[model samples]
Target: MNHAQIRAFHAVASEGSFTKAADVLNVTQPTLSGQVAALEEIYGVKLFERRGRGIEITEIGRRLHAVTLRQFAVELEAEQVLLSARGLMSGQLRVAADAPYHVVPLLATFSRLYPGINFSMSFGNSQQVLQGLFERKSDVVVMPNIHEDRRLHAAPLKREPLIVFVDRNHPWAARRSISITELPHHRIILREKGSVTRKIFETALESAGVKLTDILEIGSREAVREAVASGLGIGVVFESEFGNDTRLHGLTVRDVQLEGLEYVACLKDQKNSPVIRAFFDQIQSSTATNLS
Candidate 1:
């Protein structure tokens, strides 16, 4: 097996861009391309379909990428073992997260503890970040409400209730809380369908028998915040994430129990690796601090 070529292919497949893969591997783009091309030529099979200004991994390429993900994870474990033996920690640590609010502090702690480690984060909805974690594109993920799976290990970070928000000029701005039934009276701004917060909110609305007809589906929390601030609609967000904004007011939900329960999760097999363990330790300690 051509180890260098496989590494080149894995980099491109994971990043979905040759330029990024080259930068990641510290190789010239042409050199990276040459490695992939040589691999394809040797196998007499085209692994990628080149479209103008982009490329898609073919079915074969995806299968090979799956194998490489496992292969690289093992390589990561081996490397971690060596680094631990030398009493030094260095190398890239990739994190995927649904939001920046909770993960940022943990990252700050880890950065302080392991200044030699390189860090990268990719953000998405919970499902997307979880998928990235399973793909090995990221070593760990900050997720909300991930299901139990034997293949994974999760460290509880937080569980906070969702709150309603309105612009300062809205009629309910002075109110400290509102019942779920009140949601039907106002236009609401919601996250996309895939959002775990939206799912939990919807479930709460259903349980309360509140049917909100006037709803706007926005793609991100910031967009929902902007919409609410512009007086487009009232918005909902986890209490922990609803930072103090002068233009908006957060009201506790009176009856419904919609909350975001987040975790720092990684593959069960990789949990013992030094960098991942360091991360889980910091987050767990942070959680303990919050509880205390």
Candidate 2:
């Protein structure tokens, strides 16, 4: 019924624990519990069910939480609008990056321009990054390759080529360029499932009728690079990601002959946010300059 109760309910629903929600809201546990209880009484429905040590949101709670999330977003946007009218742009920016290398430069530039704005970044595979955007956990996402999603509006930030890398000791290291079919027999080290790189690689391989052998899945880009450097397998990564690596020499960046991929995306509804718009503009201009 009140902003305080709504906020407490949302926090508890998100964190799944009254104690953790209290910590996040900087309120005592008892205060948070009382507010939630009051809201439950007003609604005449149990919002959450007690689990072992935490709480699970009830079906009604999920619906209410979704509505509350939108309401909170609208409220925050209203505040941001007021702040912008007063020539102030000070707020938290939550971003999820599928590929950290692609986001670093853009974030650095944004930080330099808006020194007062706080940034919270999370790194994950492309699928997870997109999920974060859908869940409203991240305001925007930077992805190496974006798939078709009705809920997202993707902007073409940059189109960069994918390159193949191998250790210096590998036999293929001496080749200038290897055919896609040649890769099926080699040990291929790829990023974990849900990564754009993995998806792109798989699609290309499938198209070429090249089935890779002995695939080793790694979680992070750095881990993939290390695995390739140790002569475990060859890896396919963005060309920009291979800068200044002395140990692992570029065998030959085989031009997969695929179209360059997009690197940025935003939730369709969140595109109206002023902060997100500004950041998108910055990224567009920066990408244009870099590509030219």
Question: lDDT for every model?
Answer: 0.86, 0.79
The sequence of per-residue lDDT tens digits that candidate 1 reaches over residues 41-120 is 99999989999999999999999988988888898788778888865557668998988988887888788888888999
Provide TM-scores for the models.
Answer: 0.73, 0.72
Instruction: Show where candidate 2 strays beyond 4 Å.
Output: 1-80, 251-255, 287-292
Clashing pairs in 2: none
Instruction: Score residue 108 of candidate 1 by CA lDDT.
Output: 84
Query: In the order shown, what is each candidate's alpha-carbon RMSD?
Result: 5.5, 4.8
Q: Which ten residues in a row have the lowest lDDT in candidate 1?
A: 283-292
Q: lDDT tens digits, residues 1-292, model 2?
A: 5999999998888666898778777899999999999999987999999888878899999999889768877876887688788554587779898767778878899899887788889988888888777666788888766767766778878777677888888887677677787887888998888877778778888877778768998999989999998988889887777877866666443545643475678776567576787788887666776555
* Top candidate by lDDT: 1
Colliding residue pairs in candidate 1: none
Give residue 8's error in model 1 in angstroms.
16
